[model samples]
Target: MAPIAAHPVRSAARTTLHTVTVAAAPDAVYRLVADVSEWPQVFGPTVHVDVLQEAPEEGGEQLLRIWATANGQVRNWTSRRVLDPAARTVTFRQVVSAAPVASMGGAWRIAPEGDGSRVELLHDYRAVDDDPAAEALIEQAVDRNSTAELDALKKTAELGADRAALHFSFHDSVRVDGDAADVFAFLDRADLWPERLPHVARLDLREDVVDGQPVVQHMDMDTRSPDGSTHNTTSIRVSFPDRRTLVYKQLRVPAAMTGHTGRWTVEPAAGTDGAWEVTSWHTVTLDPEGVRALLGPDATLADARAKVRHALGANSSTTLRHAKEFAEARAAGAPDGAGAEGARATT
Candidate 1:
């Protein structure tokens, strides 16, 4: 008798569902989910999102590259997403996933519910080589991230009439007569900020390096405000050396802010030799009660907005000016340590 043939077994994809009831219109919730660029600010795990390819028409298909924290580690992947505004659904499939993930896909469903909205997040994934340990890790990450994302979405969407007044973004730029690399170095090295920037009273910075390159940084700092009061803040920074960009999200913010995220960018000046342009961009979400306590009960949302704009802009401009000076000095053949000395002297 011939021997019986043997076949390998296959693992089935695991599915999970997470849902939240948000006190906002369905259209508003859908809009927040459909705009991928805002995910970094709206979702806790999302670090950055880059739209690799965009569809020409609305509610079409696009490709995205995203970096996010998973299980306390940073991971990146590419995904293809299809947006359907009519149905209020967004479906995504991962084209290239990080290790331990063989494949993954998800959908966001938004439906009207009693003048509010019911948001549903569904995910399906498989582990590489059907490893049980790997699958368990992925499961935990998905649960944690999905819950955090849903909570944030509910909070942001429920801002209702005050949404526009509560959220704002602005940028400040300076032209530096130096190399872009020098400007980037100054921004990346936050450990030296206490000596270089007068506003930095104390700072503790830690970096996670891979292959001799720093990929992520955690910072705790005491910053002196213009009023001589010190504010404590904690932040996580992601670095992109090739683009000369550093993106950060503050885990701890001032009393008047619910969320804060920013970016520092260095680029060569167009049509100029040995010149660079450095810019600092900020996005913030206001907490109405915090704002009231900080600025008195009669203070309006408009007052809070103006105050935040002025305070944040002042700090950004100061940082940009210092960075410009540091880079320029370095480019002028100043000794290796002269830039730091000069900055300290100015302070």
Candidate 2:
């Protein structure tokens, strides 16, 4: 999947701006992020915090009592955290049930940066009290806490890659050269075999909503080898027709084979000569046995990554080749009075 863009949840008033560069990889930094208890470990203060409440549902609400010191000022605030993993985003507020002196909330973004990674954190906070004299003190603390929090995260991600590996993800999209309607038509034909591509035995369109927005389409597919060995699994398929993108979350896979959530994005077609050509991408989690197992036990890490990319890239190329052929062929056969010249390929 592709990484998320910058997500900053800060005070609309711009009262708090804690920005810093971390010397760490995105995964390593996310470790501390996924769990807020690690705050005291990295920050000098944040001596303690207690959860006041937790909702019964996923991405539910949690009330917190945070005690910390920043820039020579000691401040305590009660806040709430709203977890939204499906969206790869989280929201925060000052209170869950009971109000407090201030509210704190933010969003996190993790992305690949060269051999390591980059993580950006943006959070907004406000002081609830009317202590006019305490505003500056609270502002300084906010700045200090936010900066230190990120620094500690960097210390962990950049230098901790060898100690413990961490992983967080952002959804990605692969582009197809054709227009949005054309892409949707091809995907609508998932029941067709690996004729358009390999490892796909079928496509099941679960629901066709007249609402005209993309919804989840549960899929059943069969992946077979030349020897007739075949594997089948159920996947959750979701697409954004307006964006010409599709995402697949693998649910069930046969033994000996592995798969997970992956976004098969179809970007707006682009070409040097202004011809529509699909640009595709494949993003997946690391295989269970790690890169070594994927590329053979003797292969190095770099080799494993390169080999995996080559393999997936090859698969993408094949699919694109087939999609191009399908679109071009469909366009070539002029239907009597059909809107061929007026055909719109704008995703």
Candidate 3:
């Protein structure tokens, strides 16, 4: 018999480079990119980020788990990053990639540009089985997300002295005399919000599931504000059921805000059985022009801050209280009438 022929393996890696000029110091811009925890607030496509393992030394590598929107869908992956503060560079490679992505790597390079800085984002990726369709999808996603991230970085960095005034975070919590799981269920099943939550006028929810378990959710909701006005918003949510936590970022924000991200957590109350603490947290970046228009020209940042805190806090407190009632009702083997209009009236 003739010798069998052998096929050579094909190399499929493709590289892309994107750059932006920012009106900030190189080190400052580098720090924004290096700090993964803030990516959810700083990047439009980022939903959440968790640091799985920290570096042993200042410039060593660290492990990170990240969830971000790709082509309007949420996906998660783990990456290893090496930080070089001296050089103002951060390099990363995906340790575990989601479907259609075989491997991925990237680097952020920040260098001096006159009085400001030039930021370069580079990516190298390969599709699973070198599939052309998957490769194109990945390319499109990278292009869209990279542009958004760079633009946001530039805008945030240029805020200069006003960044602190423009951004803020707060949380509201309630003690629920019930099981943590029941409290989490009340939050996780947001599809029932229009029925359960008085502030929710209308809601549409879609979930992406794997193996009969929901991993991500997209929500479009119309909410009634304290002023008797209705606002429509859309958001992407990532759920961690094991931790009884749900994190989300709004894609369509109100006129008075540029960005909004939030989390809902249900945990066991310390030293208390059959009791849990349910909290709602919000982080927002204000639009100065929007704030002026919405609150009148005389409104200052402080005024806008106070208005947002009060409005958001009221809604969150109402939700937490309702969730408390729902959980306690279920725990006590009482009929689940927590979503009744009478129950909402009490809130």
Query: What TM-score goes with each of the models?
Result: 0.90, 0.44, 0.94
Cα deviation in Å at residue 110, candidate 3?
Answer: 0.8
- Candidate 2, residue 33: Cα displacement in angstroms equals 4.1
Per-residue C-alpha lDDT of model 3 across residues 56-119, encoded as one tens digit per residue? 5468799999999899778899999999888988999999999899999999999999999999
Off by over 4 Å in 3: 337-347
Question: In model 1, which runs have C-alpha deviations exceeding 4 angstroms?
Answer: 1-8, 210-212, 270-273, 338-347
Candidate 1 collision pairs: none
- lDDT by residue (194-309, candidate 1, tens digit) is 98898899999988775677778889999988777899998889888788899988878999998899999988778888688899999998889999999999999889888888
Worst 10 residues of 3 by lDDT: 338-347
Order the candidates by TM-score, highest first.
3, 1, 2
Best by lDDT: 3
lDDT of 3: 0.88
Residue 179 local lDDT, model 1: 70
> Please, what is the whole-model Cα lDDT of each candidate in the order they appear?
0.88, 0.52, 0.88
Ten-residue segment with the worst summed lDDT in candidate 2? 163-172
> Which model, 1 or 2, shows the larger TM-score?
1
Global Cα RMSD, each model: 4.0, 17.1, 3.9
Candidate number that wins on lDDT, 1 or 3: 3
